[model samples]
Target: MVTEQHSFITSAKRVIDIEAKVISALASRLGQDFVDACTMLKNCKGKVVVSGMGKSGHVGNKIAATFASTGTPAFFMHPGEANHGDLGMLSKGDVMLAISNSGETAELVNLLPVVKRLNVPVIAMTNSKHSALGQHADVVLDISVEKEACSLGLAPTSSTTATLVMGDALAVALLDERGFTSDDFALSHPGGSLGRKLLLKVSDIMLTGDDLPLVKHDALVADALLEISHKGLGMTGIVDELGVLVGIFTDGDLRRILDARVDLHTALVQDVMTVGGKTTQPEQLAVEALNVMEAHKISALMVTDEARKPVGAFNMHMLLRAGVL
Candidate 1:
């Protein structure tokens, strides 16, 4: 059993080593072919149609998804289905990215003529530029690997790793050219955690109206502490007579007051409160709010408006509940 466990670990390490070597070698081969591929995708007016077979198809699907999320319009098409009528999805303005480790997947090769007829340019990712698919391509990206990671040399491990890396390279290059921002990525992934973190606004998750923990600056420190307990946000916002946010009093403030033996019952909230405490706007992203809290070493914040009025309040717990953490 011990010998078998050691053999399994060694085989896993060998696989990682071979795949890493193939990915590293791909960097040296990247040059004009990569630049041209990115240029073609950037200038394409229509969607990028990615097509492949078998394991190549799986990688192609992920590549298409990455492109779509990063501001490139792209989708994967099954080669076998293209001949039966799915080729209609290809148009004059679209660009076809065909992937095949051997560069000779018959299903993809047979559809090239019609793709060419449609005036659609082809970008082929394959091991052999001499293959039929490569011969028909306008840009041929070499995804060849020195050897397969499989012990039998039959699996598509190293080759697929190379292809996936090259696909990612193309997607990110296009992403930079288009100036894709985090907001754009969040728009595409609205249902994911990243989307929530980037898209959720402070106002969207803040306590407003009667829920806001606010006390007049002239109020007693004991009154502020009562407000904090009632709001359950570990803090309360201090507002002036004109209803502008003036300061903040928190649990930490209470601890210091107790240590100093200040009369909480008679001390003015404003006198003990932290003036001009860190604040954020309603339009700011929740992640930005989290940054403010972390930077100040505070657990809560007073959400203010453009005029410096406290319209809402939020704490770290709110961010966690909203999945912005």
Candidate 2:
């Protein structure tokens, strides 16, 4: 049984090594052709239509998604479907990114004439520039592999990896050239954690108005504790007579006061509260607020305006519920 496990591990390592080498070698081949592909994608006025067959199609779908999410408008059109009625999906001003390891996929090759008729420039990802697909393409990207990772040399393994990498190369190149920002990426993925981190503002998730946990600086520590419990934010802000935030009191402060045997009913919150505790602005990103909290080893923060008035309050639990954590 140990020998069988060893053989399985060896085979997996061999496959990984071969594919890694294929990817590494692809870097040396990048030159003007890669730049040209990026130029085509960058200058494209319409969506980039990616098409391929079988495993290549699967890779094409992912490549198209990467392109779209990275600010390059793109989508996958199955070659077989294009041969039917979906050819209309390709229109003027669109660029075709055709994928085929052999450069001679019959289904893909059959769509070239119509593609040319529509004046759509084709960028072929294939093993050879001499093959039909490559010959017809305006630009040929070499996605050739030295050998298949598959033991039988029949499955599309290394070549598919090369194609996917090349596609990523094009997408990322265009993304950089277009100056795509994280904010732009967040717009395309609002439902995702990255989007929440990038786009969500402290104002969006913070407790405001009556929900804000606040107390007069003159209030007793016991009253501050009641406000903290009522607001359920694990903390409360202490404001001066002018309604400006002066300090903060949290559950941690309560524990410390209890340890010190302080009189909660008699001690003013300002006297026991942390003076001028860490605060955030309403316009600040929630992720930035999270960084401040993490840095201070605190789980709650008071949001103040320019004049230092407490306008909002939030805790780690609020950030977690809002997916900012």
Candidate 3:
């Protein structure tokens, strides 16, 4: 007499154990066809057209996206749509990869004649080697599983998991074969943090020109404080008359002056400026600028060009706004 909760937990554990064994068995069955499939995809002169029905269609879409981002050109087409004008998407020299656990999905079989007339090579992912789609493919990737996790053995569970892992294995194999780099991946994901690290430049977010809060080196300390207030970055840059950065003045220095009884009204900016403050390049990434500020225990840095002129300024606040932080 197990409680309902106990029965639920036991059933879940049994499913987990069964699925784990299925995946482990699948891993050991990888063979030459895996390599051959990767090679075919990498060398395909045209797109890799992936098609399937039901749950297999969902996995096909993800596998196509992975292939496209990693250097292979691919797209997922619905077999159900092929009869409705989408079959025109197929072309000669293209490779068609079809996914069906039983390899007998009616909609997939319905598209085979059109795919053949278009002269596209077929790669089939299926559990049955004698299934219609399997017999027609140039390469057959066997994603067979002994049994599903379903107690009734009617639902798709272990079989779908094996297909997903096998698809990922194919994608990674092609990625390595094509020498796909992180830069390539970042290009496809420019809005993500990885894109900020790779594509964003200091110039993209730094303050520049009239926006710079700067005071002359010989300016009185009161004038430097005024510049800081005008800039709103809680700091001001001190530059030589030549517009070359000489030092930086911050709220920290203003506090130190008050503590020392120094007269802000009469003191020259040069007397309190921190010389050679941390700086970044206009071409450097905003993400790198953030790292430098965090490491140096400062919130601001001057952005310089190749000539060491103070071209721009930035602080941690700006980085957060730009999503670099």
Query: What TM-score against the true fold does each predicted structure earn?
Result: 0.96, 0.98, 0.90
- What's the ranking of the predictions by TM-score, best on top? 2, 1, 3
The model with the greatest lDDT is 2
Query: Model 3 over residues 56-127: C-alpha lDDT tens digits?
Result: 999899988988877788999999888798988899989999999999999998888888888888899999
Q: After superposition, how far is residue 63 of candidate 2 from its true place, in Å?
A: 0.5
Candidates 1 and 2: which is better by lDDT? 2
Write model 2 residue lDDT over 187-230, tens digit each, in one string: 99999999999999999998899999999999999999999889
Number of clashes found in candidate 2:
0
Estimate candidate 2's RMSD in Å. Answer: 1.0
In candidate 1, the residue pairs with backbone N, CA or C atoms under 3 Å apart (3 or more residues apart, or in different chains) clash, namely none
Worst 10 residues of 3 by lDDT: 301-310
Looking at model 2, residue 282 earns an lDDT score of 98
After superposition, the stretches of candidate 2 with alpha carbons farther than 4 Å from their true spots are: none
Determine the C-alpha RMSD for candidate 3 after optimal superposition of all C-alphas: 2.5
CA lDDT of 61 in candidate 3?
A: 94
What lDDT would each prediction earn against the true structure?
Answer: 0.94, 0.94, 0.88
Comparing candidate 1 with candidate 3, which one achieves the higher TM-score?
Answer: 1
